[model samples]
Target: MKSNYFFRSIHAMRGLASFAVLISHSLTLYPFFEFRAAAAGVDIFFVISGIVMCLAIEEDTSKLDFIKKRIIRVVPLYWIATGLSVAYIYARYPHMSHSWDWIIRSFLFLPQQPGVDMPILYTGWSLNYEMFFYLILFLSLFIFKNAPIAAACIVAMIASFSAVGNLISYNYFFKQIFIEFSLGILIGYFLKFGGRVEKNLGIFLIFLALVIFFIHNKFASSGFLAWGVPSAMLILGAISFENSELFKRNFVKIFGDASYSLYLVHPLVIWGIEWYVLPEHRGILQVAIAIAISIFISIIFYKWVEKPLMRFLSKNL
Candidate 1:
């Protein structure tokens, strides 16, 4: 089946964002890389999740079915990665205490102690937020006639809470990060009904969004204020190019398809390099090799494991 160019653009951006996260962590070996802004990849992810949720879920789809499909999409690969992380931690630090509660919480997508965020897989921390947003979106389906209003309501609720200084007050629900999701929903609303801009105007909006991105980096520390809005604008701008030639590239679409695999599996790639490859060849060479190997392995893993499993589960579940 042919892929939608709009979604293809979104997915391609996802691949790029995932790569930014890989680079952000990998470049820690070189302090001169100066890519701290790449950490905003997570912000981009949250925005994408918010947007995709509103775009993908159908109006006729039941809430339970929606939740089940989300679980099928997210949980299986996550569990595999978490189990590997737990095993590695055990082998590496057998003397350290292993909290079953933490492991269970990680599996359940619950936040760890001190009311801060920690998951056994470490990167699974973002999955916690994803699951939280999914739950909210699922419930909203029961109460609202369409996904857009539900998304808008979510944004309004978070914005109001933020105004009252109650953001992040209700544990994880009212977090500042949720604002990104809200922004994404608003963008999704526009994409669903707002129609397209002229090609020149779209190009200008994209340029303006880039300017906002750099300005946010200069002035803002908060991810929501910094990268989130710019990320939303980028998505909006990218959608405007759905009918253009650039979005038709097959390589970009394939990279986007492998993005979820890259996101879930790159930590293992990093762990492998740190343990085996880095001690002997620890430099720019290793960084380059790590990136190449990570992407290669993620693509293979996606084709062999994630794609087949998701297809099976989608049919059976």
Candidate 2:
């Protein structure tokens, strides 16, 4: 398949967001900076997921086929990661005791039961949200037959959920974060409607404003504006604007290709650094070591696991 500049840019941004999450998690070790930038990275993924899914599914496809493709794409890698985490926990803390309940929950992608500590694969929680988004998208396939109607519905739902989330408890309202997915879908719809326009400077400025707003608020309303809106704009702008030759270089393409593996594996690397490598270390040294380890692990995982699995999946599925 010929790679488009739009998709390529999205991939690059995904890699950047994944690395940002790794850095954010690393910063948690220091006393000076407690901010978590990693969580914002998940929001970025959510938006991209929505946009990509809409674009991918624009052609007629059965819900079963769509779901099957999703499962093939997501489940295998996820299960492998979860299994590795379980094995690590068991080996390292054999005396601590094991709860089959948590294992089962994690395998099924269910929410962790109250008072049950999540497995070493705590990052898997986001996959639950991803699965939820897929279900919603699958069910709405018929209702969203008309792209404009679908886009309108998505926007309305996001607005409603945002209002509800703000007015109510986070637990009750937090599901509204899925609105980012809808925002992505709307972006695809707009693109389909010939909405491409040259506005890289404007889009970049908006993205900067959103980032500043997010940093100021520490992502309190990021799901709505900082993440959802800006990500959509970025994708649109990237698609509309002409891409430079530099962006199409082999190194950038490789990073984009490895983005997913980087995202999936970085958390475990971060946990390892925090828990074992430099448990007592503090300051910039800790951050630097953690980042170094994360990058190394990300590269290995991408080369050994992600690329091979994607290739196999593409061929078999």
Candidate 3:
């Protein structure tokens, strides 16, 4: 392992995690099965964001540049998706006035509801956490030059804000999900400094993740634990195979590259099916169709919309 060595595992896991989130929502929409573990995909994503932000900062990107790139990466497609969500909302509920609080706040990445409820385009809530995390990291860049130290400071900052945020917004922004990001930051630190684990250890980590996932699902609480620890374990395991080209498939790479699109667009596709094509139908067929359609459309959106926009923007920047 080397500091600058790119990990295919990161890309591969993005694909997997995005699919898991898609499946989780699909399941939620259809009510076909009980697979709360799929929700851990959000944890997986948080960890990935942590690692990405860490690596970006460590590579000597300016604080302003870091935030700029992050905004460019996240904001464009999100706004498009939000616009679509607004249309979906109005179409669904013609009674809702145009000056709704949730609509405005969703664009600003504020909480759409009082406590723990997601925004329109439901999966967009995760982006709120992501934007805040980037802000924290951007601020940290002014103080701690060390990536790991800055990451640690981010954890503390999140904890501090979470403690105070509970009084007013009751937002998840200051909650246990940061643990996954911290875990990823620690992992990113280790890898950045040339850390590696044995294959057997990687396997063990995944096994342990499963155990923890089951235990958490069955008994453990949210906040401090929930899915954070296990998702970290799973990611740590995946990256262990980074040097082996295990995640190097073209198909896999596309999924990873297109993950953001997959995440934002799938909810629309799924609910669209529920609203028109598969209304009141509770079956796995709808789930399959939703996933397939989501993946297909996301790839197209990535290639045509997201990739081109980012390229043009980055080139100009």
Candidate 4:
């Protein structure tokens, strides 16, 4: 398929989203620096997932093939990151108690006990929601051919889960957060078939998104209301402005391609910096340097490990 301006914008946004999360997580190293606002990165990711699913589904491909492709795209890199986390855990706390069941559940991305809902690699929690969304999307294809209808079903299911979330399993998929994914799917459908808006309106939406992002960071509202709405606004605005010159940059697109690698490997980079490189120096400058290194390393990983493995698997499997 030909790459459109919207897809290009989406690609660039992926890198921005990954960096946002990296900044937010850096708060762990420098608590004095307020980076909590960047946590909205996760919300951006959920929305992207929804939109990409709509864009990517091909009637020519079998549902099983689609599912397999999704798994191969995400799981291998995720497993490597999880392995790193496990090795770190073993080295850091040799006597730390860990359950075999939890480890299995972590590796499989299954929901475990509340306290340990996250995997050995805590970031894998997001992947659980991702996989769940993929499963639901895959199955929904059998029942609904229209992407919009399937998206609506996903929204309704998440809404129902949210209403009864307190009574049901506290798995990540059941949380209100999953609604972000549904919103993204709806947005995807809009991009595919929705009417065009005036460019001024697109600019307004972008401004609105920024305003909401800043406000949410300062006030700290519910994740869905705060980051979710802003993320949707950003995507909608970006789509609306897809034909603009702003979407034509190659650097952003390259970063977007490396976004997954950046997201997955960043934590390890942070860990190394914090635990070994400069344990005593977590000042803003150190954090900045660490973030720089993480980005550089992630680009390398993307260029080498991620790209090569994906190509190999796509060709062979």
lDDT of each prediction vs. the true structure? Answer: 0.76, 0.67, 0.80, 0.79
Q: Candidate 3 — which residues are off by over 4 angstroms?
A: 1-3, 113-116, 160-172, 218-221, 277-279
Ranking by lDDT: 3, 4, 1, 2
Residue 175 of model 3 has an lDDT of 72
lDDT of 4 by residue, 101-201 (tens): 88888889898877765788877888888888888887777877674357557665775566663666563565677888878777766666655556788
lDDT of 1 at 83: 90
RMSD, every candidate, angstroms: 2.8, 3.6, 2.6, 2.2
* Model 3 TM-score, 2 decimals: 0.91
Model 4 global lDDT (CA atoms, 0 to 1): 0.79
Q: In candidate 3, what are the lDDT values of residues 41-153, reduced to their tens digit? A: 88889888777766666556677887788888999899999999899888987986765677788888986666538777688878887887777777878877675567666
The order by descending TM-score is 4, 3, 1, 2
Separately for all candidates shown, the number of backbone clashes (residues 3 or more apart, or on different chains) is 1, 0, 0, 0
Worst 10 residues of 2 by lDDT: 165-174
Candidate 3, position 242, lDDT: 77
Evaluation by TM-score, superior candidate among 1 and 3: 3
> What C-alpha lDDT, on a 0 to 100 scale, does residue 281 get in candidate 2?
58
Best by lDDT: 3
- The most accurate candidate by TM-score is 4
Q: State in Å the error of residue 165, model 2.
A: 7.9
